[model samples]
Target: MYSKVVMDHFKTPRNVGEMKDADGMGEVGNPVCGDMMNIYIKVEDDHIKDISFLTFGCGAAIAVSSMLTDIAKGKTIEEAKKITNKSVAEALEGLPKNKLHCSNLGADALQLAIKDYEDRKAGKVRPPARPEDRHEHTHGESCKCPYCNGDVNAGLEFCSHCGKEMNDSH
Candidate 1:
């Protein structure tokens, strides 16, 4: 069952539209669940001046996206980048076990949006759409440890560089 906060957010999602003049945008999808999310952000003086999203997903996914924008807006870029899947889920007072993945979609989309904003500010070319293209490692081959951003081999239980347990949350 969904939490009251979840239901409230789903019934009246916030920042629920696209921004044509957004400074950065990110899109992500979960093929298995058929959930897709697009996050748009506008920055000023290194802060998230505005944020919005368009989510094609279940109620939980919609709620997560709504909460994510609320959490990110007005925060500095560095602060917003720290918003994680666990944080979003906690903000909603927690989601059903089966719907936990929805939080990941929201956080990942936000991270990608922030990265796009940074890249644009640095005058760097946008990376390709593929996950592997955005990351240094090949998809399913390896990934950066969420704790330390160290290269971690796929399927590892703990990050070799950070020694942190890799749980379902990460």
Candidate 2:
């Protein structure tokens, strides 16, 4: 199941709309399940000064989006990028296995949004579409956060599971 905060967000999400001039924006959706979430970020001096989300799906999706925005605000771009699905799940106690993918959607959306922001800053290629547009994709690629799951990324100096420092990168 989900927590009270999770449920509250699911029932009545705060900041559940879009920003006209958002600094960063991310939209994550699972094509298989048709669950989608859109998160918006307003950054100030490299910090996520304000955040919000709009999700069109189940409780897990709404909860993850709500929790992600709460966690992302006030964090630097680097720190915000480090926010993982595991962390979001932990913040909500835990999510059912089937619902676990919701965390992945949330994390991925946030990451892509921040990436979009960074790209804009560096004059990189702008996203092909608007930030809120739903792009179809599979889940669970870099989805595993080894710090809480299994093994880390290959050649990772730190555990991909726990994010703990490791002696060897290989």
Candidate 3:
């Protein structure tokens, strides 16, 4: 069952749609659930001046993206970077256990967008966005652990750095 807050957001999700001239953008998907989220942010003076999203998923995923934009808007880059899956879920008044991954996608997308913004500010050239390039591993040949963004070896059941259970969809 969804919470009232969750239902509210889902019914009338805020900040929905694409931003054509976004300063940064992030996209994430859950292969298992077929959930996808794209977040766009406009930054100014080290703050999130505007934010929006386009989500293709269940109600929970849509709500999470809406809440994430509400939470990140107007916050400084540093503050927005600290937004997490737990926080987004909590803001939604909690998601179903099965739908918690929706929160992860929302948070991860936000962080990735912020990272993209910073990267552009530094004049770092990045390749065109591609499905295979969604995640950039900091550790060579290792994927990032969704729970902690730590290095995770392929086919591992748990993250060696964070000790969290790994889901194949990540």
The number of the candidate with the highest TM-score is: 3
Backbone clash total for model 1 is 0
Better of 1 and 2 by lDDT: 1
lDDT of each: 0.90, 0.77, 0.90
In the range 1-170, model 2's lDDT, one tens digit per residue, is 66786787677765677877887777666444558877778888999888877777888888888888888888998899899999999988888888998999999999988987887788887747664343332334433343465644645667765677654212
TM-score winner, 1 or 3: 3
Model 1 error, position 109 (Å): 0.4
Worst 10 residues of 1 by lDDT: 131-140
Off by over 4 Å in 3: 30-32, 130-170
TM-score, cand. 1: 0.74
Q: Which runs of model 1 end up more than 4 angstroms from their true locations?
A: 30-32, 128-170
**Across residues 1-170, which tens digit of lDDT does each residue of candidate 3 receive?**
99999999999999999999999998888444578899999999999999999999999999999999999999999999899999999999999999998999999999989989989999998778676645433335777789889878876799988899987567
1-170 per-residue lDDT for model 1 (tens digits): 99999999999999989999999998987443468899999999999999999998999999999999999999999999899999999999999999998999999999999989989999999867776433333356666688898988666799989899875444
